[model samples]
Target: MSPKKATEAPLTRYRQTFSGKGSFGEYLDVSRRFGKDKEWGVRINTELLNGNTAINSNDMEAQGIFANIDHRDKKSNTNLLVGYRHLNIEGGARWFSLKAAAIGKEITKVPSAPEASKNYGFDGLAKESEGYIIALNHEQKMNADWKWFLNAGMNSNKLQRNIIGASSNFVIINDKGDVSNNLMSTQTVTKNYYAQLGINGNIKTGAVNHDVTLALDKAWHSIEGAKNMYNNGSMGSVSGNIYSGLQGNNVWYPSIETGLSSKDQYWGISLADTVKYKKAQLLLGVHKHNASVDSYNKITGRVTQTVGSDALCPTYGFVYQPDEHTSLYASHSENFDKGTIVASKYANAGEVLNPAKTKQNEIGFKYANAGFLTSLGIFNIKQANNIDVYKGSDMYLQQDGEQEYQGIELSVNGKLADKWNFMGGLMYLDATQNKTQNGTNDGKTVNGAAKWNAVAVLEYNPDEKFSIVGRAMYTGKADIYNEQLQTPSYMTYDLGVNYKTAFNKTPVTLTAMCYNLTDKNYWTAYGNNLILSSPRTLMLSATFDI
Candidate 1:
């Protein structure tokens, strides 16, 4: 056998960008080939931000570096990747949770100034954070019809928060417009490890072809953390109001007490086979999964609880192609997930609950012709173990109910003409919570689940060196507090231009974009929490092929 031709030559690409909102970012990538069978690459990404609006002051910086080595032969390929990243945050850049009653008439905008946010010792709090990750992947081809692969990785993170504020007692606001919240601090160190080995092959029997896969995977996770609540079992028990603001508090103070320490491990085995004959393909699979968890009690200073569970989940799918440019498919699958560890504020703090189960079904179709692609899908998902405070009375995060979601999605992407391109998508969802304690929330729309969302983008290039792009985004009205309050539907637009040229024989591309073209104000919801959207902003960037 002769050596394969080299596909990768030494090349580097670098890009830098700055935004009018006081944010900067830089990216770099370099790749080269060693001989004819090996490749090496490195990537760097970093971002910096200065949050100095009229409301508060803060700063943030994030950086990451990644390197990989790839080697391939006629029958096997292996790639190893290692990465390191760091994050630093200073000042009041955290998201603020607002009460539904305070949404005011403007719907799109948050309450005025100090009413919406208050300094919570952010200036005096010692704020620092960092993370690191490493992984490895390898694959081998046994013969013309069979292959096997292995993937393994480990991720470790240690985070220590400053004097943090928890919405445990609800950051309260009185009729007189006074605002305050419960104070707390936390420190967490978590480590996760996973490994998987799999084999796949194709076999022909009679007039049908079968693709089979079998795999085994194992995962381990552990978390150790301490969270302290500074309230007297009442709302707004903290000393300072939104105006005065809490300051000069230590996250590691002796007054802080509660903690969580837990460990979890899981093992899974899966087998799947797809059979294809004529224009139809069918898939059948099953997964056997088991998990064990152990939680330690802070007061008892000992392992207090141990839980284990196992489940056999199945999946099936079918696809039929009636023509060269169209296909229809349907699939159903079941999954299981280990329960999350209870937070410090919950009555069952440090306890690991049982596993949650989920089931999903989908039907979709795809059509492609004439440089155009279109797809539409409808899906239904039912999930158990939705952690929530039941009836506003339970202190423990309980999975007393389930949630069901059904939605339809449609998308189209391709060329509209020789130099024009378009991409668009829309989705409509109907989600509800059920089986709650006393039916307090039964039949109610799930909070933060939007009913409709859509986006469209169009790009035009008159020549080889210049392009213009326009985009529009729309989000429908959504329930913020389970129908008690709803945010109004809103839309925003963006426009951008790109120019390309050669500098000293090196290719370069420059871009300028303006987001929120009409300076539209909007509110984004996250599980009953509301956040104001960014105003009109401009960003400029330049990329160089060095």
Candidate 2:
């Protein structure tokens, strides 16, 4: 008889997200080999997110699960996969505002409003959602050096809100300190669906190779809501007049009797080729995209037709190696963003708009020696036909514009000693606009583009049973739109330690980790004065493998 074949067991792993708020969650992932070929496998993963903000009494929770099966030939000539995923999110708030003006009512200053707090109430909001998705993919080798692949997928999502109780009662006071006790409750729901299909292939010939891909997608969405107030004792009465624009008794009345629906179709195709000879390689590609949108009125429920412009893009790159330990590369690419249906619905009587475009270029070098790898790169990017939100107005403006961004980045990773390893990167950017609405070139910078950014990591393993790791990141000052505000960048650090051992001959591991050690105050994004940043937090986890 033949010798007995070896069997491979499944593998499992776990991870957790650390938050400053007392909110914590974890994920479990497992993968297993299938059949004697060892080229087929299956994987499953589950994750959860939960946390509470100081503004709300109830905590928020989100959960997601996914599973996939993949199979491939031993020669990697054919491959197949199937996948499914589900996600659920639920949370509650003291109050939820649907419109931006409602948000302006709670905060004294318009621009100073904390974006996060406004999502629910002065300090309360609640929301929940569930999403489901399925996918199938296949790849086959037609020749010794040619392959074809195709994928199709679909997704469905539903969202709902729950309002049950209030922990505190508060009054909205004007500049004159006039107070009004108005308590209200409301709920809303929304649903969305999406589907997509795509195919790609590649071929090789002598010293040249060619690759191409195409894809198409479609999506649909809808929303509905109702509210009830405590003081009015009526289901659809207006509570009080906050903004001087509408006539109603209570705030729970049906205000927006409107519904919106849209149908979108998109097609994209790209062709890329590479030529290799000696110590150098050259790559070039061209891509084209076309899309159209049709919107249906919620009240009339009639489809309105709109057409989008076709976009053409081109890209090129070169790579050269002068020695075994050093290499250099450079690339240039163009990108475009299509105008949306909203612009067609709300544009001036005869206004017409075009898609925005961006051109980017970069050059870089890489060196590896003595178990250390280092890289340096420089990039320049410019954008035209840009879109901007009009200052002090709720309208958008499109202009023949130009903005430039120049940046340099450097990174290194290596082992310094028998027990230590480190990796770090630093980047500096100089960005400004060459043209705006003012006719003249203003040196104003774009928001969210920081001038300096850096990340550092260190790891130490003294023995096979114990290890420690630390990481830190820093972001420099960035510009903010509106009021010409400036947001100060901040630094965050994380550290973790792990211990492993055998229990009853079963492998076990324990880890303790801390994030945002300094609890530095910073804004997550620009334009929203949301003092929202990950706070300092600690997490402890245990795992077992059998």
Candidate 3:
């Protein structure tokens, strides 16, 4: 039982990078335990305007920090781990732009026109968010075949936005050339706090593994906003029948508003079992979730609004490995998009709704050999009770509709030669809104689902000291709106080089990365009459290890 000979020494590595835009930055670190068999590390990341295509006046910044610690003792059946994370976001498009077809009329993008000498107040809104989270977890082995774990965490967020400029201008011009404008402005602030507790365990017997988890969570949110002015000097009035050649006006005034906040409590339990025998494995699971939101409406001056729902989700899957080099699998699962709990509480009674639900099925196969590995998968998803904005309403509502998305994905990764390695994947999607109320969207396509997408990378490592890499990506045409407005597809490329050597007996590494090498114009997401994408940029970094 004497201690074994030491085979490896502790190692530490550090890296930092600065990009051309001064917004894109990165840091990395690696560490290993020296004596106590404990390891801890952290990573810091920041990206600015990575691919946002908003006009020059618009800007964005993001920062993230992640840290983890792990400790283990061979004598005890217990272990402890802790994690912390922080994320911050600021800036974005403030003012919308108009499309070519909607030039003459005040459409989605046009704001109130500025006067010659008066301040237009046309500045776009600025958003700021701060979040802090911490998690503590513990694991215990109850027996040779049973293990259990418990985790608890808390998170708090402060979100505020300064909205300048008038409200959106929704103007329509009839054949007779009459014009009208609707203008308004407001500022909003929201704060949220969340706490969660969960416990899970697994038991192994023969060829079957049983797993179970139960969790409870609570969230509190506060929202405050002032509607300073209404359109066309209208105050304390609500617009009605404002479309179809009818003119309606509303006037809203700024007032010190304090409404009763909203709170939500949720609890869920899940059980899963996996049976593995021979080359075949089967997994089955079911989950039950219950949630409730309660709030007091200032207008009503009473705590009388409450919304609650319960749902059960089931999943099943099977995998067969016919040989060491090939395998096939299929799975079916249900996913839920929990509706905004706070929003439902403040809205009018009978307007609140439960979360949307999605059913998904996927089948895939994989093949691997000494020099090649590949996988192909086909998946379909159907969603119901989607949340969409009503055409003329300022409030959000849920629709009893269904949408379908089917897609195929293919991927490969392997070494082509002693010094060359490659990895790539391709995805194709056919997304459509299958059914909708009023039949207005019966044949419409879903936005943001590109018909085709692909990425490939090649890396050459001739020796340990020097290496090079190149990457390319292609995104095919995608519908910009549910009505099938299409945006053109695009392609982009990237390249990188790295050198590692010993300086004064200490290892040093230098890297240079160039992204969007071709500087192509590509849109990531478009809506609300705005388009965003990123241009090419270069980044360089150096690392030291001991």
Candidates in order have lDDT scores of 0.71, 0.56, 0.56
In terms of lDDT, which candidate is strongest? 1
Q: Candidate 3's C-alpha lDDT?
A: 0.56
lDDT digits (tens) for residues 1-546 of candidate 2: 111112256777666554434567777778787777777777777777777533233365767777766677833422232233333322322221112232336433322223232222322223445666666666666666555565555555543333222111122234222223333343333444444445456556776555555545444444332322233234222222222211223334322222444555566766677767678888878878776555555446676555476788999999999999999999999976554434311222113345577899999999999989999999999976344453221234455467789999999999988989999999999877776667543677765567899999999999989999999999887664422445567788999999998779778788888877765545543322223454455777767775
**Clashing pairs in model 1?**
none
Residue runs of model 2 more than 4 Å from their true location after superposition? 1-9, 13-26, 48-58, 74-124, 161-260, 341-353, 384-403, 527-531
Model 2: weakest 10-residue lDDT segment is: 163-172
- Model 2, residue 57: C-alpha shift (Å): 4.6
Q: TM-scores across all candidates? A: 0.86, 0.74, 0.74
Which stretches of model 1 miss by more than 4 angstroms? 1-7, 39-56, 92-94, 98-122, 125-127, 168-178, 227-260, 298-301, 345-347, 385-387, 390-396
Q: What is candidate 1's local distance difference test score?
A: 0.71
Better by lDDT, candidate 3 or 2: 2
Number of clashes found in candidate 1 = 0
